[model samples]
Target: MKNQEIAKILYEIADLLEIEGVEFKPRAYRKAAQNIESLSVDIEELYKKGQLEKIPGVGKSIAEKIKEYLETGKVRKLEELREKIPVDIESLSAVEGLGPKMIKVLYEKLGVKNLDDLERVAKQRRIRRLKGFGEKLEKKILEGIEIARQRQHRFLLGFVLPEANAIMEELKPYVEKISLAGSIRRRKETIGDVDILAVSSQPEKVMDIFTSMKRVEKVLAKGITKSSVRLHGGIQVDLRIVGKESFGSALQYFTGSKEHNIEVRKIAIKLGYKLNEYGLFKGFERIAGRDEKEVYKALGMQWIPPELRENRGEVEAALNKSLPKIVEYDEVKGDLQMHTKWSDGANTIEEMVIEAKKLGHKFIAITDHVGSLKIAGGMDEEKVMEQAKEIEKLRERFDDIYIFHGIEANIMKDGSLDVSNSLLKQVDVVLASVHSAFRMEEKDDSPRNKSDRK
Candidate 1:
């Protein structure tokens, strides 16, 4: 579980390097950090096997650094970089529209080393007098700073899910049934904290194990029915143990949007029944609770998926028995976007194809980066043509899946693609995306915009 701990240090190193105006190395560090963070295997185990270099985007030097940290619990280079920069760059850089280059400029010009410093300078109207900043940009920076301050404690769903799943897996043996609830279950883009509910006859044992998890940095509370702990990454998690008969009702009550719960409660009242975490009751008799479907059946509605319980007409849909079917992972046939060593990806084309086939995919597209995105080592027309030939040869070896040659073309400032139209037309798939001009507020009236508008 040192994966996240190592990733955090790598990200901090990337920020320090960016602040120092070092080019290329920051992107490499960040890519390695991302791959490591997403790894399913324990990093400590990988280090033990001396296989850290086998990780995609990780090279000899980076692997050595990982080993150094694993062995000694410190990284010399990162500490030196931290001493040189000497600021909380990650927090400052998190503000919307604030990139490393702009951060460097602010730091050198106005001594803006953190959010507070930046906010103070913006309020004083000193930022507008800088070379490229204006009154409008200054106003936007202040707004972004305020938003960042408000959301500072929240973590991305993608970042926190792995830790949550790990904790649940460890607790599985002690509970009859367990499920994640709260924002994590609702699939929110950002989560304030984690909530877990379990059906267990042994609440005391479960609570003890929950509060003493390996990742727990602090045990906030430990009680008979519920326990709360803060993880190493500052994510607070609460675990509740309930009777098996009431598990479904408890899950529905906890996995909620406030608005959705209010609407459901109104429905319960209308039906002459009372509903709570314990169970659904009709005339003081417990009617349903063992399953979520039963609870919904008692309310004269279809069971709703957790993702759709946001008070966005889901209640009405359930009443009409017309809730949409949510797509499951098994329903996916292929992946449209992927990369290989031809661009910035960690694996080779053949390696990626083999893995895709193992995943039961019927098809895959290798959409590597192309043209002028120097940090990604984007391919030019000649290199892309070379890659196409290589992919053609590799196609001869695979019979189970259809492999498409693709490119993620960079959209230039003038609304033209980085790759020529002739080359683009030859590919099976093309992905056009914006990588710069993040601060531009005005919408383009170009043909691309017109088509999208229509």
Candidate 2:
């Protein structure tokens, strides 16, 4: 079948699955459509070669449909589905909590095939007074219609992150692996959030957790094709499920800032290759790449880190193979400054050490505010010495880590260190900083002549 024809079929299937309340299945079709759309290969050639299955998310059933499309001009299954459903699929699908099955019911029983008809029924109090739906459900459905119309264009990221994390955590017990992608993963800070890609042997249970998140907010859209909700913080989150094989590609595609992927595409084009969210494509074929590394290696480039992927210089660097070594979390060996309850911090000297140990740190200095500022509960010399004694005691408890007694000594107006040399020498580290002198004039720090000070 032509790609558009397949896309239409997939869209219909997705709609039906949503109305039918089958979670994850809709994502399979959507992913299929996405994969096919991103292909650089001639669809006709792939169909003839029976290589459609090589595409992520295109399983045996979809492949057969493609073959049938190649043999004939139209898809029988799609035609049958179209005939079975009313012409106003989009309108009927807009009603919240109503999917294909509900659509069928609305069409057959109520003669309602669109939002206008559904709204009229709702206003007439007919649906509210129906067997299963009450006044509350009808109100919810009406609210859903408004939301569907207003947010029909874009998603917001501020809302999507928490819902994604909650769903991922819920599915953790059932699946060994799951990841959130789309704008949220891109660290866009604000997002038109996309679906959470979860992989598991027990996909049914994983999908159940997704629908279960409905209680946290309200289910705005639900289908076997896709499920979306307005989470507690007014965030709309979508969750997609695919087999383990498709997880890598789907995650990459969904998590993309399209501009960055366009850069990847440029690289692919230069190297006589094609790249998409699914995997690296080489002239109508999927190259073997189960992960992002493989995808880049297939394109003859180093792995492109996510942070450097604002589409700025990524493509140029990739082609030249001169990408800078971006810092990773593991490379941080020490925290230069932190606080303790001896000053105004949350933890005590002992408790802070425990916290640092949990983070796998080698050393941490308790640079408490001392004497200069009253707001931070700055300590005097006696209190600093008392804190030092506590630190010495805690030192015996930990042999693998170093705990330093230090102070964030204030910088005076003349650019001099606040603490005297006697106290400064007693500590393992010193971090002199200006807490209140932010407006001070810049100073040149070459050794001044003693005669100038006099």
Candidate 3:
């Protein structure tokens, strides 16, 4: 059990004590609960080692309760409390900004013991009629309810990527260029949704196609420059169509961390222009004609890379006209880390090599697991040499491709590589990873013992 879990048990115990008319003891438990909730240290571990009394207000009684929860999976006082109340305590407590005392009053007087009942009473305006709840409190509650609904408005990026790609592919014929913009373009691990910018002379045809798309559950809004749709998977897709000349500028605007764009605007002001999603404007006149090249040129700098546009120091760097050349995915000559079926991957080494060749990669590595990962069918030294010989044979057959023989070796204890160095020289690359000892010492500042036990 974690400290938070122990704290929660104590909080409920305090609530039950309050109802039972127990005096300062309940207050003491409540104080201990509050302290434990904020504690960074694990209370259950402390309790095991007889250190729980160190926390202020946590006496012998509370320390015993915490220890009971850790060993027996139940605290006696908490169980008794739950039995007496017979209420959905956690559910009632989840109401925005409402704590235990308020929950007790609501449950005792109005019979509003759960979220659904509370929501119903609030919607009916009866909650404001209760003591300690006035017109202002009711308005805040309704606003909180509205916020809860809005929280569901966004979608996960993993869920949205494929749909966005499908839509972009569908529009490719009509548009001169199509770019996936927004958070997806910026490579956010989780995204609210997707934004796509397209350049098309045939705007009406593009709009018609977009509106008639089968995957779009409903068209939220449609305008000249922009159109938004709620997809079948419950993600919103926003599309903007601009002229071919204005496409780059439009892309820069839509592919924004809004804060980053604000800084971009400030930089544009420092130069002699204004930046917008449409294009760069120069004081009641258009400059750069229609290209984003003109936008960077007007700012007296090389093209600002999108990934660096987080406003940290990119703005200052652009003003000074000094930015490092960022590496692109295409620039990576080979993929060093990957899996194959010789260990645990679904594909064979040859299939992975073929795929790499299709990507026009310079080299491909077939680095499967070695014997510390028995579950992955990790090979021993004999199997390692056999795989190496097989790779050499494949290299001769595939003359056009440079197939690098490699192994993703596991790290053994005593801080050493799994495979012998003589065997290591046969491969072009070595990828080291840990399949064990992860939980004990993988933290940013976790201690590692260097002395060999063996």
Candidate 4:
């Protein structure tokens, strides 16, 4: 709810701080913002309880800022930062692979301040002449800008999921049965819109409540059986009410990959049946409609998981009764790659471990950044050893879960790791990642690149 709004402002503050070359405060703000975004409870409720500081990563200053926002609906510090920077920093940051440091460089070097300015510079080939940027990187920036432009109206699945769930919770009281459908139900990484289907005896009442939702920015249409509204974030949501008899059919039809539906339709026709949103029929007698399983069974196949309904051999697998079993969310035991306060993460080792234990984890790895990635407050050999000893001591206090001491080491441009092999051998796990040189797309077939690629 307000968590996202607060997090966004704090992120902007972080960006401005970075642009102005303020170091530690930006990290602090970013950490606090990240923790706030992941919070399960309402931030306002935490403020009312005077427990804002208790949230991991939030300190006294940040807590006061949160209180200020809840009270005045704005953070004064962010407003002041915006005034000084005088750029639409958020839009510029949305381009892939463009970090705050680079943004600052672009501003200082070419007076580029926004997406349009960056695009103009790239087109003029001026960006390639800048230090640390070449033709390849400049081209990539142009592509990234275009992609960001295309995705402006869409939202990430992770970002939109909580809001969609909240909306579903609100509508539960009014509908007989409701299900979320569309790309969201299919769990696509980015969603253009949300589709919700419900079964209700009083369709008109359902439509009324859907249109009148507090978060509804505008009602596009309202009808007896269907309604459409735009949410606060420009996300379009469509709600459809269907009879109980057609609920399953409606769900199947709406929760579709167009290709998947075509294949299923072809199968139905081969079996002497006609399928539609209302029902699967054999010469006018309804064979399956009330239950999704019935529809699949009638076509001599097992019901497919929504995620696999992409016409990617799923239909064939279902027909052969050889569909692979997908892992349930609960089956995941632990996270191997996560940060704690030892590096750039907001939470402390104990706090992170405690949260993981609460989630029923059997084990987890504390993979803080190591070596030359100074932006993440990377640890050196001495600090890594110190952290390992601390983790060992912490292990004695908790027997419910196993903790692995690990480091996320940076891979240097020359194909060497930032951390020494001797130090890496001492840890339970090592995660090597590329933090720079994101623009060079062609594999460096040079001997150095070849060895590194290996």
Candidate 5:
């Protein structure tokens, strides 16, 4: 938790530095932030051991900032930056059409410090009067703000999953059984909140532990069987404690894509068993409730993985015993695509390989971002060749794993590859992806003809 907090401060410092047009330091700060966030162990533990600089990207300068934050609950540099700028860079950056440069301009020219100020300026037609921001840009800004407003609070699972796992780990010793429920368990792309289910004899004690955790920013509610707290990052997590007999059913009940649960309940009704969070019952006689598989078995279907429970064909497939054999976590052997410090990834190529090896991956690829995605720290042809040398050295040291050297080249707005065909021939693999000019019309999404290019 302290790791994430310190990393957030570093990231904000980087953003503030960029807005101030500082040279070189913003990228350095961002790199340090990435390394901090990627650390497998607690940064505070490292601090206690006086080994903060042991982290990949933490140099003497960045290490000092981390120390200040850990010792004082805040960094003085970031506080100074915030006071000087007095603008909410992080929140404003979320608004489309509002990049760092644009944000700086808005702050200086119109005194726009936040999303509301930007909206107010755009609506009043004052933004169009700015030298470069014409009526077209102003119109787009309004639309982007509306879109951002509707979806501002939703967080990507990649960012929230670690926190969820950490919280569960903390409560493991106190609860009889515990699990992450809701869309988080379903592996949904965007999560509005986190739901945790547990079987605990001491419900009140568990709730107290949950609401009192250091990562918890505020305890929204406290109850004997249920409680909710807003984490430091603004994700509200709800804890539900049920009877041991209801543990499995409660998990199934809360780990839903709503529509999926409704379909399962319908199947239970047809099978002459009533189903709910408590258990599957026949005329009030509890039958299957202690295990999730038993509930599915009573409904005459396979137990679907939470990720596949989206009310798709999974229902019918489960019933017919044709449910696809999803790859077990251990069954996976290779990681085909990943980034390193060459791009926006937090770790170096060797560090990534070492961690992947720990995860039992037999093979992996170093597909760092390249060509035209500078915001992601993309590399050029020269840098790509330089990284290949490092990867080759790593291959010699680690003989057990196959390391595929590759590049995640960006797809241009015209749907053309960013890396030259000549340069592409040098790599073992090439992964193409879209990074810019998104939200284009369907017809423009495909590659254009060579003759159409200017």
Candidate 6:
């Protein structure tokens, strides 16, 4: 889908505009980018149908920008912003403590344009000399640069999943067996490359189809057993065709987090077996080469799920047969915390309810900000009563899902809730949160507090 591609450019535009100190438009661009990014359907399809404005936060101006991008593959305004500011916003933003304002300062004062430039400036002790920037922040920027370097080219799992699935669907018919392997199989939050393991006697044919796919930007290497290609979006896809006997073992080895496989190999050694990509071996005889279950069974352990194969005590748990069942994504039936347009959220209460219903949620809470947190447009007691009336009407309209009229009361400096008891009793739930003064010293729980409670 062009959704991610378009969303990325729009997000860049937002950052670029923000760097230029443009008001309101940056936020508008960002919100539009967010709405487009979350869309399940193609942005191109919406553009074709001229329904881009139907997307929340997308007005005619931003919708026109999206259309311009789709039709021309570039936005003129974004290009102009890029030429003016010329800062690598994404890389700099990846720094935990850095923001657009700081980036603007660094660019204006230190000529910091990218992570590398930021690091150089931080190391040279130039940032600390500037107003509002300290030695500590400079040190933090250096550390952040290291982190950004590590995360440089990794794609979000959500972005790469569709492409990987599409490839599998295309190549499934050409192989005896096939499964996603590597970090993709383990479902890492960020992925470096796509790895697919398949068993096929006709490896040549499989490799041909895999490398020749429409998404392939360049064929890095192509062989009978293995092939690697760079996708148009810069993600690498590696296809490997192994023997049917070694498919499971290959799958297990390839789906490793390195540390997980290392521990599993140690278990194999302890049990007088050798484990590798080919199979689990016993004195050179293949003991478990057919399936993952048998391979783990041979190791005297339960088979580990791909997600849990991160070497985080999973091996021990599997060996002890004490692996806890992890909750699947679809197992969630309700979302307890949410905000509507009544507060800072982009969507309305009814819109949230409709989306939640589509996602199979049995219940949802509309926990809008309330009380003295005016920064978030927090509702007062009177406004809460008004929202309650609206929710009651909604609850009647949507009978399938339970709607909870909730309030996110701010926790004041003294650690007491900003909401009143009378108002609290009126809502289904009270989500008391620290909305301000995050770095304040914690108040001691002295006997005085207990005495006040008494």
Deviation (Å) of 155 in candidate 5: 3.0
Question: RMSDs, each prediction?
Answer: 3.7, 22.2, 18.5, 4.1, 3.1, 3.8
Compose the digit string of candidate 5's lDDT tens values, residues 270-329: 888888999999998989888888889888899999999999989999999999988987
Q: How far is candidate 1 from the true structure (C-alpha RMSD, Å)?
A: 3.7
lDDT of 3 at 145: 57
| Full candidate order by lDDT, most accurate first | 5, 6, 1, 4, 3, 2
TM-score of 5: 0.87
lDDT of each: 0.88, 0.70, 0.74, 0.88, 0.89, 0.89
- Report the lDDT tens digits of candidate 1 across residue range 1-454: 8888889888989988987889989989998998998787899899889899988889999999999987887999998987776677778877888888888889889988889999999999999999988998899899999788878889999888888898999999998999999989999999999999998878899998898877898999999988899987679999998888888888899999888988998999999989999999998898998887889888999999999999999999999999999988778889999988798787789988988888888999999999989778788888888998988998898977889999999887667788888988889999999987665546664566755653
User: How many backbone collisions does model 2 have?
Assistant: 13
lDDT of 3 by residue, 196-301 (tens): 8888888888877887797777999887778998775457888888877678787778788788889878878877788886678788676653666567667676
lDDT for model 5, on a 0 to 1 scale?
A: 0.89
For model 3 the TM-score comes to 0.57
lDDT, candidate 6, 213-327, per-residue tens: 9778799999988899998767999999888889889999999989999999999999999999999998989999779888999999999999999999999999899999988
Per-prediction TM-score: 0.88, 0.52, 0.57, 0.83, 0.87, 0.85
TM-score of candidate 4 to 2 decimals: 0.83
As for lDDT, the candidate ahead, 3 or 6, is 6
Ranking by TM-score: 1, 5, 6, 4, 3, 2
Error of 2 at 431 (Å): 2.5
Supply candidate 3's per-residue lDDT for 45.
65
lDDT of 2 by residue, 158-184 (tens): 434544675677768877567777767
